[model samples]
Target chain A: MNNQLLPERTVYLVSDGTGITVETFSNAVLSQFDQVRFKEIHLPFICSIEKAKEAVIKINNTANETGYPPIIFSTLVNIDIMNLLKTANCIFIDLFGTFINHIEQAIGHKSNNSIGRSHMVSDSEKYRNRIDAINFSLSHDDGQFVNQLNKADVILIGVSRCGKTPTSLYLAMQYAIKAANFPLTPDDFERNTLPATIVPFKSKLFGLSILPERLSEVRNERRPNSKYATLEQCRYEVSESEKMMRREGISWLSTTTKSIEEISTTVLQEIGLSRTLA
Target chain B: MNNQLLPERTVYLVSDGTGITVETFSNAVLSQFDQVRFKEIHLPFICSIEKAKEAVIKINNTANETGYPPIIFSTLVNIDIMNLLKTANCIFIDLFGTFINHIEQAIGHKSNNSIGRSHMVSDSEKYRNRIDAINFSLSHDDGQFVNQLNKADVILIGVSRCGKTPTSLYLAMQYAIKAANFPLTPDDFERNTLPATIVPFKSKLFGLSILPERLSEVRNERRPNSKYATLEQCRYEVSESEKMMRREGISWLSTTTKSIEEISTTVLQEIGLSRTLA
Candidate 1:
């Protein structure tokens, strides 16, 4: 076993574009070494040498403060900026360099190596699709545009504060899916059926339920001391909504403990929508 | 050099929750090796041994069909299920096991190893914060809720279809940032200043502009041949909006060629908002 387990260390996520790719990558690798705590600093849009030098200074300062060499995870495409960053007092992990070289060797051609190419809106068709999805999601939110229900790829239904909107937006932004979400209010629970507007789209409906106490807590934060925020009302609503889902043969999952990402993924999986990179 | 370059490979992303962490991690790693094409399959909520067996069968069949060991990137926390998956004929990359062990040792306690813990909305404070951010973004979208402009952590200004909505949603969903976006219409450009409602919050404003031709192309797809979709109108809007931003001393960026992630990162950086993982 490696004996280099430190109590804490500084980590820098450097990127020419969003720094999201490097951040995600570093988190994954660092998650494996749980012995060390990381104080992460994100440096995005380091496309110029001046910015790169500034990043080096920041990284070195972090190293000096921490009394240990920082770990710098970078996805820089520009050779000059990459070289400048290399002069920092840290262990540099080049996320793109080796892979680009390998790709060049295998394809027998040079890469564009343009800064910020990975996250560019270079493909017009994909960009249009994403924008269309976003527009559709926004218009269809909270059952606002019921007439356009037919255009939806997935319709998420649940009681208020059950995490419908964020999940819908995530589905739209991440996968370009036209996800519409509707709230299952007390009126729907009293009727004991899905909303009339979404009835025609039962095949596309997915449900999200939450623990009654948790639901009450979430609702209370929004509207305290109201019938809508009462634990009894929350329990009744959750049970009735879930029952309605079962009777309608719509699949449902609990949002009591799941993140928006998890809820969105389950919704997509239930709707049989394949994840696509846009 | 080893002669193991394949034209295509099957990549399975297996997880106990959303599979998002594994998917993001795998994509970042695979982006390095750009030569090989990946046919990615996402298998989420694999929490049971039965599901693990099913995943193994699917993985083995993929391997047999491809005549190469399929690469399976998993974030399963269940030891028994992990062992079961190991029976499959594929290259398994364990994302959690080693880290959990190291963390357990360093912390001097055993990890709960509960499935889907990373993305769970278990903490009420954080969950409320995220929901609040999402609500703020949605309510303030397209300059609708300008009266509440002061509540925004960042206010993004751009012409229509300049990728503000998606970026705002991303920032809210990912980092719990209360981002509001206002569209820079021809009216705002005509005045040659920031909107009156947002003038007091000038420090929170950022701008997004796009190439006029690209803006025209994007708009034409929505409302073809109309004044709003005409190339001349788009050019005028783009140029005027940029000039207004510059004259007001608001930092502006071109969204014509940038992705939402890139745009959001730049916005956050310019506003000095530290990226916080929720």
Candidate 2:
């Protein structure tokens, strides 16, 4: 009841681009503070002085209402707009402003100081590569297009609902890595060998396993009351898949409590593939 | 040739967890220096003193070989390990070390001082929500599942290869929004109306568009020499789709030169949906 009486503090994510970078960075930092009940307000594309002034008004209003100043994490590139935002009644943490001049001194050059440089289509080749990677992951999802397995940077093998698809797509979308995923069905377990097509790319194979209880829960969402969703069946598949992975000497991780980002990072590290943003 | 002769400068992304946030922050900051060509090296999972020592060796080696110090962007939470890293022979930019103190002061409390708190599965409910959103987006891609359009936060409609699939997936993956995408076909263009299944949820509709020349180029990569990949057909489909979207009073944007982040941001802003991280 006392917690409920506390007013929610405001945290503004201000950026001249999509605010994606600032949001990610802020989440990483703010997640460490568990006591503050933060209400995030995104002020994206604040490219002009007018927009900055408007954001200032919003920030000041929130501070007035909450009786506590808002915390603003801004990544503005324009000097004039940033100066305007700095005047707002808040704890202004300028992300770019804090680091840009230091980087300039170290690199011995001036920054481009352009708006939307981080998440824009400045390099057409890299943009096309990312699109192609996404298309590849889509077609190759769930062993759909096994014919192009040779082009994949990593082949993820796992039982159904073990988080193969999301991990593959994340690797492709964020890192521009062509990741193909294949499910280990009952037949593969019976045969007691890796999938024939994926055997050729053994060096790039990564396996995902999950806790049987959790796997059954995830499967029940797709097909309730079916044998596939039974706890016994999930246990069987997970054990067999682990055995197969061990026999094939493929690096594997349990995805029972891991996020997609964690799984993708582990997969890239195990496969010795350094992440390259598209 | 002179540009090629310049030695590739190293930029180390050091973090205690998956390093996703640090990589993103580094990219956003380093992208401003268009003149410096950086070679990124990931030193993820650096939670131990041993790992931090190894990173110092690598940074020093790189500095010795290149005759210039590398730029190290780190987000380590361990004060002891971070202090050790500060002794390395490089331009150290401590991401967390720089701002965590200020945030602690402003919030009037001590941080939890935990490792891997951001990208880890710390919140099980939010993690499940993200996984569920990904599954929903995958099932609804290219108009596969229309029965649950009412449950979606946003529905993206556009001509084939006009950047609907990637945009939809990015929204789900990054923002944990239930985003469904439907491809506008020639038949829809001939009929001159939105799809019947999507008409009921007109308020949730958002559209994406692309240049005909770019659309043709993207399509040709998939199905070469087909009528669908021709410039004329792409132009017809794009123009008709735009007209239909305008007539139906749906907000839309051109994705021809936009990144997935940019397109997703615009869609969320236009749909009046505040991005909620699951």
Candidate 3:
């Protein structure tokens, strides 16, 4: 079915922090309803009673105008504010409150219920490591600073525009993994070997290849109608890179239709790095 | 209470996708219980019944060894696989199942219930924009490619090592915001004005300042004992940058104690950009 022709619904992701957790949860859940088109609203940093009341008013107004109750997925930790938000004219899903009680009972301790702790810089050492990883990924991007390639937890290799840079950044930002990406140019294909700098870190290598059509589309956006962006060049580069990776026995995947999250997860899984989610 | 003195718990985040959503939700909920120490295990991309059974076995073994039931937060969509996982000796929290039924009742439609759809590149246009944003942020980082600064949705201005780079990248990766960052170097501070290239786009500028001590520590990591890494020099740069931003009437914040997610959200909010979370 055409997504536009599907039924429309309004959904709100309300939280006292950046609203990222609640938004992620709601998006995953709502993606299951492929037959519905959702208009999402993010009401983040709603920690106080005043903010909660304002959200309730906004949610109710949306409901009144749409002639249907909006759905609210909230991670508000303040009991009073959560109670106020629950009074809104919507199907409220208490993401935190529902689990906190059960977890408290199981653990034999009451939750502190303070707001905005999840994404805070509570552990300065861990936060510092994440920042360091970002800096490492940035400095080592696109095969630059190859002398320091030994510091990378995972080094991604692929043809140009085959989903290396963004995936590297995501791995660094989300997992605090120091990721370095090297682009496989025509010279590397001609050599028919991994770069000398990466030869020692074979276990740290992960390869990403893309479909030629998608690679051409992506490249053409930057260099329109150029020989460099032509479909034939893209096809040659992708196939050569894939053959090279296979010959070297390096684990790889095609990133033609995958999201950055998926590509990063696959790379981590392939490289056997199981980091706790940041 | 001292966190180390509290009871330890074993928790598992199981999913048929990247496990990011469940991990995010579980982290936020678990952070509320500061008294409990958690050892987290992530089992992602578990789509088949065999994987589900394996996860059950792992959870049961963990429970037996810990002498307590492990807590399981799962987003498995397949009914059969979810039922198999539920048989484990653990506090099974079905994150998706708990909400899908209510949402179905509200919308009067059964969900598609497919696995791994949430983080897939289902919408090529949106995914392409995110990649473009990432590329823009990279090319425009730290005052490079300022000739195209007009294309930026928000330009972050701050002293060196004041949390500008990571925040810019996070905004681009997470929200697809074309964020460009320029360091407020000693040259800009000596001139006592905003950079000439940014004068025309003052309205798009947001400033980030860091505590001098923290800035010194961060800079010390890169260039130890250098004059630029001294706390006294850091104070001068931070104060001068703040004075310049104030004189230019740009919205600014202190990143001394904030996370990258927090800084990005605040920048978006201050710049009046309400992008849907990707």
Q: How high is each candidate's TM-score?
A: 0.87, 0.97, 0.95
lDDT of 1 by residue, B1-278 (tens): 23256477788898887787777766655654545677899988899988998999999999889887777778887889889989999777776663455444433545556776657765668877888999999999998887788889999989998888888888998889999999988888777777788888899999999998988888887788889988899889998998888888999999876778878887887899989665
Give lDDT tens digits, candidate 3, residues B88-141. Answer: 999989898888889999988898989977788888888888888999999999
Docking level for model 1: acceptable
Give me the runs in candidate 1 sitting further than 4 Å from their true place: A1-8, A28-37, A47-51, A76-87, A94-117, B1-7, B32-36, B76-83, B94-117
Q: Which fraction of the native contacts appears in each prediction?
A: 0.43, 0.83, 0.84
| Candidate 1: fraction of native contacts reproduced | 0.43
Tell me the TM-score for chain B of model 1. 0.90
lDDT of 1 at A121: 73
Please write out the lDDT profile of model 2 over residues A1-278, one tens digit for every residue: 45456446789999999999899999999888777777899989999999999999999998898888999999898989999998989999989879989988988888898877889998898888898889899999999898899999999999998999999999999999999999999999998888787888999899999999999999998999999999999999999999999988889999998899999999999999868877
Model 2 chain B: lowest-lDDT 10 consecutive positions: B1-10
Q: Model 2, residue A93: displacement in angstroms?
A: 0.9
lDDT of 1: 0.81
Across A1-278, the per-residue lDDT of candidate 3 in tens digits comes to: 77789879999989899988988888889888877899988888998888888999999999999998999998888889888988999999888887777888888899997998989999998998898889889988999888888899999999888888899899999999999998889988898888887889888899999999988988998899998899999989999999999999999999987899988888877788976765
C-alpha lDDT values of all predictions: 0.81, 0.90, 0.89
Ranking by TM-score: 2, 3, 1
lDDT of 3 at A137: 93
Best by DockQ: 2
